[model samples]
Each structure stands twice: as C-alpha cells, then as structure tokens.
Target: VKPTTPRGQLPLLKIDGKQYTQSLAMQRYAAKKAGFYPTDDIDALVCDECCDTLEEFLLKFPFAAKDEEEKKAKRAEFVKGPMTEISKFIEQKIQDAGGKGFVASGPSVADIMLMVNVKSVESGFMDYINTDFYTNYPGITAVTTAMKEHPKVKAYYDSLN
Candidate 1:
C-alpha cells in the first residue's frame, strides 16, 4: 500500500482518486483548490518560500534527544536561537508586506503554514516545551488568531475538537 508514494509518508493526499505525496505539495494543491493561493506571482513565491522554510526548520530540530536533560536543553536552545530568528524574520516579512494578516495579501497559504508551525510550538505537544515558545512572537500569534477566526479555518478546527 505504501509503495505508490515516492517517500512512503503518511500524509499522502488522495484527491479525485489520485494520490499525492509530500505535505508541502499537498498543501499547495489544497491551497490552490481553496483559493488560498495568492494571485500575484511574487506573492505566490513568498507563500511557497515561507512554507518551505518552516518545514526545513522543523526538520532541523530532533525531539528525540539522548535523555530528558539533553532534550530540555536542545528545545530551549532551539526556541532561543533558530526559532527566534526565524520567527523574527517572518514577523518582519509580514510587517513589511503590511501587518494586515499574512506574508501576502489577506490570508494565503503562507499564513496557514505560519500559524500551524507557530501553534505547534505553543501547543505543548512536546512535554519539555511550554507556552513561552511563542510568547515573544506577537506577529505569529496574530496570524494564528486570524486563521482561527476565519470561517472555514475555524470550522475545520472546531470539527477536530
């Protein structure tokens, strides 16, 4: 059953009976279908870049440390260093584009990606991490709030709850 996917990943998207691999690729396809993709070429590029950047950062942090002590230290360092830098850059990007709601016009795929990634840090899924993960990044929190208030986005999350 897993042989069809190029990378054998669980998040394979099946649309119209066709299978698609890679979370980012599926996200882009879904965003296009949902009219979340930006109309301008540069805007779309920025959206894609933001999503890819988050994915890369997530990949860099390995939660499976040798022990609890190491785990806590690693997570703390991640939040203080790379994570902070990335969040600041994203915040500035949103600000430079106008602090309405996203890295591009209104709420695009980039906004969704940003919200999801930021929420993961704040959600405390990792026992070692805490709410402090996102307290310093108001811009990211703003995006999360906007996405949460969006009609469809809210509905989807509500269904999960």
Candidate 2:
C-alpha cells in the first residue's frame, strides 16, 4: 500500500480501482461517506477550519527536537504556550456550536482528529505531555469523552485491545 501511494504514506485509500492519498483528505471523505460531515456550508467551513488548525498544530510541534531532553522541554513549552491559546479557541468553538456539538454538527472528522490528538497526549506519545492536558478545559474533555464512548470508536478500540 505504501509503495502504491503517491507519497509513500500509510493511509492511502483505494476505491473502485482509484487511489486517494493524504490522511486528512481520506478522513474527510470517510466522514462524508459515513454521514458525519456537516451539510450546511458554514458548518462545513467550521469543521474544515478546526480540522486544519488541529493538523497544523501537530505539524508545527518540534518532533525533530535534537535530544530527548530538548524534545521534552519543547513539548512542555508548546503545550503551555500556543497550545493553551488553541485550547481556548477550541473550547469557544464547541460552545458556540452548542456544548454538546463536536466541531460543526456532531462527531466529525474534526472530532476524530481532536480525539486522536488528545489520546496521543494522554497515552504518552509525547514524553512530557499527559491526559491532564485537557483537564482544565471541560469542553475539550467532553468532546474526547464523546468520541471514546461512541459505538464504532469503542468497538474498534476494543478490537485493538
């Protein structure tokens, strides 16, 4: 699959003998096909923006930090600084959309991305980060909780374990 992908990425999607690359593009396509993507133009815009913003944050992280110690320091600084502001914005977006809504309408590609990133922090994927990252933000916690308890998500994770 990686060899067939244009960029040698793991998430290339093949359908009807056609291949689609880019994880975000595939995620969006899946969300749409699963009927989770918002139908309203503004809602779709919000979902897209949230998803892009979250992806950008992950991309901007100092994953290439020179040493383990430096990586830990960089991750800590990032979570305390820009990540704080991003969290605030996410909290606001959730509230603006209604407290229970994830991203635009409900569980969306944006929500899935957010949930996975949150889990990464919690699961020690980032050495210096922990589940406490979202402790101060109820809205973010709620979203992750919803995603975790979601039937399909839960079933997939259960299968993994």
Candidate 3:
C-alpha cells in the first residue's frame, strides 16, 4: 500500500487514473465537491485557518520519544501547554464566528476537521491524556455536538454502532 501511494503514505486518492497525495489537499477537494467548503473568500480563509491549526496541533504529538516515560512526560507537557493554547484558539475562533457551532456561516470542512480532532482526543487512544480534556472548552464541544447532531452525520455514526 505504501509503495502504491505517491508519497508512500496512507492517504492516497485516485481519480480518473490520476493519483494524488497530501491528505489536506484531498480533503479540500472533497470538501469543495461536497459543498462543505466555503465559497466566500473570508469564510474560506477562516475554514483554512481552522483546519491548519487543527492539523498543526495533531502534528505536535511526540511520536518519536525514546522511551515510554519520556513520551508520557512530553505528552503531558504538550497537553498542559500547546494543546491548551490551541484549544483556546479554536474555542475563540468558534466564538468569534458568532458561536454558530461552525467557523463559517454553515457547515464547512473546518467543522468536520474540528469534530475529528475532538473525537480523537476524547477517544482514550492516547496515553496520559484525559478523555474529558475538551469538556472545558464549550466552543469546541458545541461544534462537535452540532456536527454529531446533523441528520446525515448522526445516521452515519449510528450505523457504526
């Protein structure tokens, strides 16, 4: 699978016999096609900003720590510092966008990205990180709740159970 991908990565998109790499690029394309990408310039910028910030936060995970204790300490430090900071930034962004449960006028790729991030952190898959870490950030919670409540999204999640 790795060899078949353009960048030897998992996220490879094939369309019309053309292969595409880069998860974000593929996400943006899919979002646009699905009408989940904002059409307005400013809204698009906000969506991009939110997605980029979320990706940045994900990239900060210390996956290369030399030992379990070191990894735990690094993760703990990250949760206490950068993670909190990024969460606050996302919370503020959501609030600044009128607290509409989205960073733009309607559902966008940013909302989806935010939902994914929230779910990931709360999934208990990461050691030394509390699943309730996002509870304090109402804005983040609101967006995730809103996304989950969407009829289509709700149905999809329900099907998984």
Candidate 4:
C-alpha cells in the first residue's frame, strides 16, 4: 500500500483520481475545504508560518540512532534544546496573536496543527519528555485545551470511545 503512494507515505489523499502526498498539503487542503483556513491574506500567511514552524519542529526529532541508548540520549538532547526553543517560538506567536491560543483571529489549520503537536508531546509517546512538558508553556497548552473542548472535536473523540 505504501509503495503505491506518490511519496510512499501513509497520508496519501486521492482527489478526483489525482494522488497527492505530503501530510501538510493534505491538511491545508482539508482546512480550506472545511473553512478552517483563513480567507484574509495576512491571516493565511500567519497560518502557513505556524504550520511550517510546527513541521520543522517535528522534523528535528531524533529518529535515527545506532542503539537504543543513543536514541534516548539524542531524544533527550532534542527535548532540552530544539524542542524547548521551538515551543518558545510557538508560545510567542500565540502571545502575539492576542494570546488566544491561535495564530489567527479564529481557529485555523495552524491552531489544529499546534493542538496535535502539543498532544503528541504530552502523550508521552516521545521518550524522556515529560507528559507535563507542555504545561510549562501556558500559551501552547491553551491551544490544545481549546481544541479538545471544541464541540466537533469533543464529539469526535467521544465517538472514538
């Protein structure tokens, strides 16, 4: 199944018989279709900036190592360095946007990306990172909290249970 995708990735979106790869691109397309993308140019730029920054952060994760211990060490280093810096950058972006837990005036794809990143970190799926790591960043955590409480988001999670 993976080999059949354009990029051999899990998130392959097929629209009207056209195959599309790249998770972020698919997310943006979905956002636009669902009205979660900003119409205003500046707001849309902010959303793109936030999403790109989040993507960069994810890419910095230490996924390749010669051994388990080395992997853990590298992950710890990432958590202490790049992870902290990126989180701070995002926190400031949220603050600049009126501390609303969103890069734009309202919830956009950027906010959704932010929420997902926060959940991933806080889920303890990444070793050596405390589940409460995001707790220190109120602005970042606020986005996750708001997203989780959103009616549609809440209902979707409820249905999963």
Best-matching candidate per lDDT: 3
Rank list by lDDT: 3, 4, 2, 1
Clashing pairs in 1: none
* Backbone clashes (count) for model 4: 0
lDDT, candidate 3, 27-139, per-residue tens: 99999998788898989999999899999998987666899999899999999988999999999998998876555579888888888888877887776789999999888
Give the Å shift of residue 79 in candidate 1: 1.6
Worst 10 residues of 2 by lDDT: 98-107
TM-scores for all candidates: the values are 0.88, 0.89, 0.89, 0.89
Query: In candidate 1, how many clashes are counted?
Result: 0
The Cα local distance difference test for each model comes to: 0.77, 0.81, 0.86, 0.84
lDDT of 4 at 68: 89
How do the residues 1-161 of candidate 2 rate in per-residue lDDT, one tens digit apiece?
67767788777788999887788888888889877688988889999988988887787677878898888899888887778878888888888887665554567777877888888888888677766878888888888899899887788799998
Error of 3 at 24 (Å): 0.3
